[model samples]
Target: MFSLFGLTVVPAAAAGGDFAPPGCFGERYGTLFGQGVSVNCFPGEGYGYRVIAHCANGNAFWFVVGEFVPYGFGPAVAECSGALLVPARVVAYEVDEI
Candidate 1:
Protein backbone atom coordinates (compact mmCIF):
# COMPACT_ATOMS: atom_id res chain seq x y z
CA MET A 1 0.00 0.00 0.00
CA PHE A 2 1.00 3.58 -0.65
CA SER A 3 -0.31 7.03 0.08
CA LEU A 4 -0.24 10.15 -2.06
CA PHE A 5 -1.98 13.45 -1.49
CA GLY A 6 -3.82 11.77 1.39
CA LEU A 7 -5.20 8.86 -0.63
CA THR A 8 -4.04 5.35 0.01
CA VAL A 9 -3.07 3.41 -3.09
CA VAL A 10 -2.51 -0.27 -3.65
CA PRO A 11 -0.07 -0.86 -6.45
CA ALA A 12 -0.41 -3.83 -8.73
CA ALA A 13 3.19 -4.54 -9.56
CA ALA A 14 4.26 -5.91 -12.92
CA ALA A 15 6.96 -5.71 -15.52
CA GLY A 16 6.92 -3.10 -18.29
CA GLY A 17 8.85 -5.38 -20.67
CA ASP A 18 11.37 -4.31 -23.27
CA PHE A 19 9.90 -1.00 -24.36
CA ALA A 20 10.09 0.45 -20.89
CA PRO A 21 13.16 0.76 -18.75
CA PRO A 22 14.25 -2.48 -17.21
CA GLY A 23 12.09 -3.41 -14.21
CA CYS A 24 9.97 -0.30 -14.56
CA PHE A 25 6.23 -0.49 -13.91
CA GLY A 26 3.53 2.10 -14.16
CA GLU A 27 -0.09 1.95 -13.06
CA ARG A 28 -3.10 4.14 -13.70
CA TYR A 29 -6.18 4.29 -11.50
CA GLY A 30 -8.91 6.31 -13.13
CA THR A 31 -11.68 8.12 -11.32
CA LEU A 32 -10.63 6.66 -8.06
CA PHE A 33 -13.59 6.27 -5.73
CA GLY A 34 -15.52 8.77 -7.86
CA GLN A 35 -12.94 11.39 -7.05
CA GLY A 36 -10.38 11.63 -9.85
CA VAL A 37 -7.62 9.85 -11.69
CA SER A 38 -4.21 8.76 -10.41
CA VAL A 39 -0.95 7.60 -12.04
CA ASN A 40 1.87 5.86 -10.26
CA CYS A 41 5.30 4.82 -11.49
CA PHE A 42 7.74 2.46 -9.86
CA PRO A 43 11.31 1.97 -10.94
CA GLY A 44 11.43 -1.44 -9.38
CA GLU A 45 14.97 -2.56 -10.11
CA GLY A 46 15.50 -0.12 -12.96
CA TYR A 47 15.48 3.64 -13.40
CA GLY A 48 12.78 6.20 -12.68
CA TYR A 49 9.69 7.07 -14.69
CA ARG A 50 7.01 9.67 -15.39
CA VAL A 51 3.31 9.75 -16.03
CA ILE A 52 0.83 11.91 -17.97
CA ALA A 53 -2.84 11.37 -17.36
CA HIS A 54 -5.31 12.63 -19.96
CA CYS A 55 -8.80 13.40 -18.81
CA ALA A 56 -12.17 13.59 -20.53
CA ASN A 57 -12.59 17.17 -19.40
CA GLY A 58 -9.65 18.16 -21.54
CA ASN A 59 -7.36 18.41 -18.57
CA ALA A 60 -4.04 16.69 -18.29
CA PHE A 61 -2.17 15.79 -15.13
CA TRP A 62 1.52 15.12 -15.04
CA PHE A 63 3.37 13.18 -12.36
CA VAL A 64 7.06 12.54 -12.13
CA VAL A 65 8.17 9.43 -10.39
CA GLY A 66 9.82 10.09 -7.11
CA GLU A 67 11.84 7.80 -4.85
CA PHE A 68 8.95 6.47 -2.91
CA VAL A 69 6.04 4.08 -2.98
CA PRO A 70 3.14 6.18 -4.18
CA TYR A 71 5.73 7.89 -6.29
CA GLY A 72 3.46 9.94 -8.51
CA PHE A 73 0.62 12.45 -8.47
CA GLY A 74 -3.05 11.60 -8.27
CA PRO A 75 -6.60 12.05 -7.00
CA ALA A 76 -6.74 15.40 -8.69
CA VAL A 77 -10.42 16.08 -8.09
CA ALA A 78 -9.88 19.74 -7.44
CA GLU A 79 -7.67 20.48 -10.40
CA CYS A 80 -10.51 20.10 -12.91
CA SER A 81 -12.63 22.87 -11.38
CA GLY A 82 -15.78 20.76 -10.85
CA ALA A 83 -15.67 18.97 -14.19
CA LEU A 84 -15.81 15.21 -14.17
CA LEU A 85 -12.22 14.99 -15.23
CA VAL A 86 -12.68 11.43 -16.19
CA PRO A 87 -9.38 9.85 -17.09
CA ALA A 88 -9.03 8.77 -20.70
CA ARG A 89 -5.59 7.22 -20.50
CA VAL A 90 -2.22 7.43 -18.80
CA VAL A 91 1.03 7.74 -20.72
CA ALA A 92 4.18 6.67 -18.98
CA TYR A 93 7.78 7.37 -19.89
CA GLU A 94 10.83 5.72 -18.46
CA VAL A 95 13.67 7.85 -17.21
CA ASP A 96 17.01 6.25 -17.73
CA GLU A 97 18.44 8.47 -15.02
CA ILE A 98 17.35 11.03 -12.46
Candidate 2:
Protein backbone atom coordinates (compact mmCIF):
# COMPACT_ATOMS: atom_id res chain seq x y z
CA MET A 1 0.00 0.00 0.00
CA PHE A 2 1.20 3.49 -0.86
CA SER A 3 -0.10 7.00 -0.47
CA LEU A 4 -1.12 9.09 -3.46
CA PHE A 5 -2.67 12.50 -3.20
CA GLY A 6 -3.28 12.04 0.51
CA LEU A 7 -5.15 8.79 -0.17
CA THR A 8 -3.98 5.23 0.20
CA VAL A 9 -3.32 3.26 -2.98
CA VAL A 10 -3.61 -0.45 -2.59
CA PRO A 11 -2.21 -2.68 -5.30
CA ALA A 12 -4.51 -5.46 -6.43
CA ALA A 13 -3.73 -8.47 -8.52
CA ALA A 14 -4.92 -8.19 -12.08
CA ALA A 15 -4.90 -10.63 -14.95
CA GLY A 16 -1.72 -9.16 -16.39
CA GLY A 17 -0.13 -7.31 -13.55
CA ASP A 18 -0.49 -6.04 -9.99
CA PHE A 19 -1.25 -2.35 -9.86
CA ALA A 20 -3.58 0.26 -8.48
CA PRO A 21 -6.03 1.99 -10.72
CA PRO A 22 -5.80 5.76 -10.64
CA GLY A 23 -8.79 7.41 -9.06
CA CYS A 24 -10.03 10.56 -7.39
CA PHE A 25 -11.48 11.41 -4.00
CA GLY A 26 -13.66 14.24 -2.87
CA GLU A 27 -17.06 15.37 -1.62
CA ARG A 28 -20.39 15.06 -3.42
CA TYR A 29 -23.04 17.66 -2.89
CA GLY A 30 -26.83 17.33 -2.82
CA THR A 31 -29.04 14.45 -1.74
CA LEU A 32 -32.05 12.52 -3.01
CA PHE A 33 -34.22 15.62 -2.82
CA GLY A 34 -31.76 18.07 -4.24
CA GLN A 35 -32.14 19.86 -7.52
CA GLY A 36 -28.85 18.91 -9.13
CA VAL A 37 -25.79 16.77 -8.59
CA SER A 38 -22.20 17.99 -8.35
CA VAL A 39 -18.84 16.52 -7.50
CA ASN A 40 -15.50 18.00 -6.49
CA CYS A 41 -12.77 15.59 -7.31
CA PHE A 42 -9.11 15.72 -6.42
CA PRO A 43 -7.91 13.48 -9.15
CA GLY A 44 -4.66 11.60 -9.07
CA GLU A 45 -1.76 12.69 -11.27
CA GLY A 46 -2.22 11.61 -14.87
CA TYR A 47 -2.94 12.87 -18.36
CA GLY A 48 -6.43 13.87 -17.26
CA TYR A 49 -9.57 12.72 -15.49
CA ARG A 50 -13.33 12.92 -15.71
CA VAL A 51 -16.33 12.66 -13.42
CA ILE A 52 -19.33 10.46 -14.17
CA ALA A 53 -22.64 11.16 -12.54
CA HIS A 54 -25.00 8.22 -12.39
CA CYS A 55 -28.59 9.11 -11.74
CA ALA A 56 -31.32 7.11 -10.08
CA ASN A 57 -33.38 6.93 -13.25
CA GLY A 58 -30.67 4.98 -15.08
CA ASN A 59 -29.27 8.12 -16.62
CA ALA A 60 -25.56 8.65 -16.69
CA PHE A 61 -23.79 11.95 -17.33
CA TRP A 62 -20.13 12.42 -17.95
CA PHE A 63 -17.95 15.46 -17.56
CA VAL A 64 -15.44 15.81 -20.34
CA VAL A 65 -11.78 15.63 -19.49
CA GLY A 66 -10.05 18.88 -20.18
CA GLU A 67 -6.51 19.45 -21.39
CA PHE A 68 -3.74 18.36 -19.09
CA VAL A 69 -2.22 21.05 -16.94
CA PRO A 70 -0.09 21.41 -13.89
CA TYR A 71 -3.01 22.25 -11.61
CA GLY A 72 -5.66 20.35 -13.59
CA PHE A 73 -9.21 21.29 -14.48
CA GLY A 74 -11.98 22.70 -12.34
CA PRO A 75 -14.96 21.00 -10.74
CA ALA A 76 -17.90 19.76 -12.79
CA VAL A 77 -21.64 19.25 -12.18
CA ALA A 78 -24.21 17.20 -14.07
CA GLU A 79 -27.93 17.78 -13.99
CA CYS A 80 -30.30 14.88 -13.58
CA SER A 81 -33.16 14.80 -16.04
CA GLY A 82 -35.98 13.55 -13.81
CA ALA A 83 -37.57 15.71 -11.20
CA LEU A 84 -36.06 15.32 -7.76
CA LEU A 85 -33.56 12.95 -9.27
CA VAL A 86 -30.61 11.98 -7.16
CA PRO A 87 -27.19 10.77 -8.08
CA ALA A 88 -26.56 7.15 -7.22
CA ARG A 89 -22.81 7.44 -7.52
CA VAL A 90 -20.07 9.69 -8.87
CA VAL A 91 -16.96 8.07 -10.26
CA ALA A 92 -13.66 9.69 -11.19
CA TYR A 93 -11.13 7.78 -13.23
CA GLU A 94 -7.80 8.73 -14.69
CA VAL A 95 -7.42 9.25 -18.42
CA ASP A 96 -4.11 7.58 -18.95
CA GLU A 97 -2.47 6.51 -22.15
CA ILE A 98 -4.72 4.38 -24.32
By lDDT, the best candidate is 2
Q: Which whole-number lDDT from 0 to 100 does residue 55 have in model 2?
A: 41
Q: What is the C-alpha lDDT of each candidate?
A: 0.36, 0.40
Tens digits of lDDT, candidate 2, 1-98: 98988999887544312121334333445545432333334545544443344344445544433333332456444533344444343333232321
Model 1 residue pairs with clashes? none
lDDT of 1: 0.36
Error of 1 at 7 (Å): 43
Question: Model 1 over residues 1-98: C-alpha lDDT tens digits?
Answer: 98989999997445441133444444443444222223244534434333332223245544433332333432111111223445233333333333
Q: Per-prediction TM-score, please?
A: 0.28, 0.34
Q: Model 1: what TM-score?
A: 0.28
Error of 1 at 13 (Å): 25
Q: Cα deviation in Å at residue 19, candidate 1?
A: 5.6
